[model samples]
Target: MSGQQHILEFRFLAEPTDVNFGGKVHGGAVLKWIDQAAYACAVAWSGKYCVTAAMGGIQFVAPILIGDFVQVRCRLVHTGTSSMNLIVDVRARDLKAVRDRLATQCVLTFVALDAPDGKPTPVPKWIPESEEDMALARYAEKVMEVHRRIDQEVSDLRPAGQDH
Candidate 1:
């Protein structure tokens, strides 16, 4: 509907040079596409430059091949004071295929930034409007919780007084 809405879709054909040595589309290319889509969605919602803060749960479900039509769908699932949690799914289908198959999925966090200073700025709050939206929002919360625990564990492992 509107650019400020929760969803953004990016569709394009997989190019010949996008493949890896195995003849399948490279994961790096797919990741780049996913990041681009997420960035677009974040900028649209925040109306400010947004930088990726973190990415998690990256799953490569299937391989993408050259000549397949690729689609990257990014959806805003939750929001913190200055961050937006987005779910990005990449799907691809051959020319004759009727439906696309999931190729990759990940959750990305982007933080809106204030210009000049490049400090984190508050983003517009996101409200779930449907059951699906609510479920996704809850899922994002769980993902963030796991990330927090992992971060804490990593921090605890560091030598005392060595923050770097």
Candidate 2:
């Protein structure tokens, strides 16, 4: 909405189907919304088809109830040669409420692909302008570092000459 292609926001009413047996919106449903929002932001920023590469730091802080207003905000925080990292925040508010409560938050990585060959393709670089943008980019970098460490640990655990 601000002419920034790197950001996307979705707002919708929570449906009864989104509720779990506990009378709140289910975790899986919230994750689906996060993915959808992140995917849209990735595609918008890259101007190409994008696939989710990884998801990390998922935190479900609160539960969304049926009939609440749900909003998912996704913004590009960092970009690699072919991958874009997005910070997705999901919030919910009762219809009569004045403020929204954070329901979930996570970082998602998406990779752009060439249309013909389906290979990873470079996406346009994003430059941070404001302090908030810079901070978010730094947070994304930290998340990537964590992912790298985990991957390395997993690889180290695997038997030599065996790639799984």
Write candidate 1's Cα lDDT for 19-85 as tens digits.
9999999899999999999999999888889999888888999999999999999999999999999
Give candidate 2 regions above 4 Å deviation.
1-4, 159-164
> lDDT per prediction?
0.91, 0.91
Tens digits of per-residue lDDT for model 2, 1-164:
21259889999999999999999998999999999999999988998899999888889999999999999999999988999999999999999989999999989999999999999999998989899999999998888789878988999999999896
User: Which candidate leads the pack in lDDT?
Assistant: 2
Total backbone collisions, model 2? 0
TM-score of every candidate: 0.92, 0.92
In candidate 2, residue 138 scores what lDDT? Answer: 93
Please count the clashing residue pairs in each candidate, in the order shown: 0, 0
